[model samples]
Target: MNQHIQPPTSTASSRIYDILRKDLVGGRFAAGEKLAINALKEQYQVGLSPLREALNKLAAYGLLIQENQRGFRVPRLSRAELDDIAQMRLALEGMAFEQAIVHGDAAWEAELLAAEHRLKCADMTLDKDDEWERLHTQFHRTLVAPCGSVWLLRFIEQLHDQFDRYRRLGPKMPVIRQELDQQHHELVELAMQRDAQAARTLLDDHIRKSYDVALQCFLEHSG
Candidate 1:
């Protein structure tokens, strides 16, 4: 595992932040699980200060919640949270897609197609490999890149980071994740055709279905 991980070329704090954030998103710890500083120090081979720096950063990202004296824990997940995120994605990303269709140039179209292709060709089992997460993010971001709203794009990316932890811990497994490839491909297709109604419908269904599956997974495991 260590062999594949790139050695930190930046500050030790930066490396710790990157690695810890990935683990949080990867479900290395369950939601709301306590983050033990002593254990983490031994796990990542880092000093106390740098570890604290990393923890503080993750808390800033909302991946971890920090308590006054309790330190940090992975952010808790809930059905209500999922619903809110789904609706926000539907509103924000839906608008981005509509705007993209209106203003999308040939370059935007090409990037969207390319993003879809990369996702298809990559193994994107959400629970398995981290590369899949990067590709998945790229594909979604590319779809809305022509929307001309920087703030919207930033919000979309932040929401995706929040959404990822749930997906990683979900029980739908690799097979169900593979099935999402079709939805992704069709989203690109509808975007290319500039069919806003069809595209938004599909996008809404896509995000909602994903949340539904993840919610079920959480319930099953939590029970």
Candidate 2:
């Protein structure tokens, strides 16, 4: 079994990167917590070089902060940062949604609705976090799949990842599943109706509401 292991610099770094990225996003490691090298080596079962490489890659993805001499730490949560991400997401995703509605074909429409349905049916309890996250991300991605700009999709994806981290790190949300499901239905209906302005407005509020929940949750937890 040991004979199959790849060298530390090559395969090991990729493996460590995947685990660390998931851990960071899933809030396994607390935000702003320093990543000690010796501790990580024991936990992840990797050499120093591979661990550093993995951490640096996460830093590039905005999931970690790497400082000189201080080493790596998870990005800290802040109300100001959450507001900034929401603003950016509103503008970028609104533009994408408009373009997608214009450029999307019938198949895209079908897939978009399908993704929404899957999300509605998803098991989003705390125990099924990874599965819930994947479905949620897919549903949102389907909304903008026909924007026809690779760069735009990439940027939005990165923002969504960061924003999602904030959501997960916060305490349990105030919005229950039924209300959320209704909002999702409304969004899909508006998109299907080609009501770009209404849909964008809904999306903006949809995002802001989540941010508000995150803010409230954070404040409550802090208190």
lDDT by residue for model 2 (1-223), tens: 7778866587889999988887787778877788899999999889988888888888999999988754888887777887888899999998999889888889998998899888877744434468777888898899988999999999999898888777776655545434555687788898899988898888888887777656764575456
Residue 103, candidate 1: alpha-carbon lDDT: 91
Whole-model Cα lDDT per candidate?
Answer: 0.81, 0.82
Segments in model 2 whose C-alpha atoms lie over 4 Å from true places: 1-11, 123-128, 174-177, 221-223
Worst 10 residues of 1 by lDDT: 123-132
Off by over 4 Å in 1: 1-10, 123-128, 173-179
Superposition TM-score, candidate 1 onto the true structure: 0.85
Q: After superposition, how far is residue 33 of candidate 1 from its true place, in Å?
A: 1.4
lDDT of 1 by residue, 18-130 (tens): 89887887788888788889999999999888888888878887888988654898878887787777789889989988898889999998898888888887854444466
Residue 44, model 1: lDDT of: 96
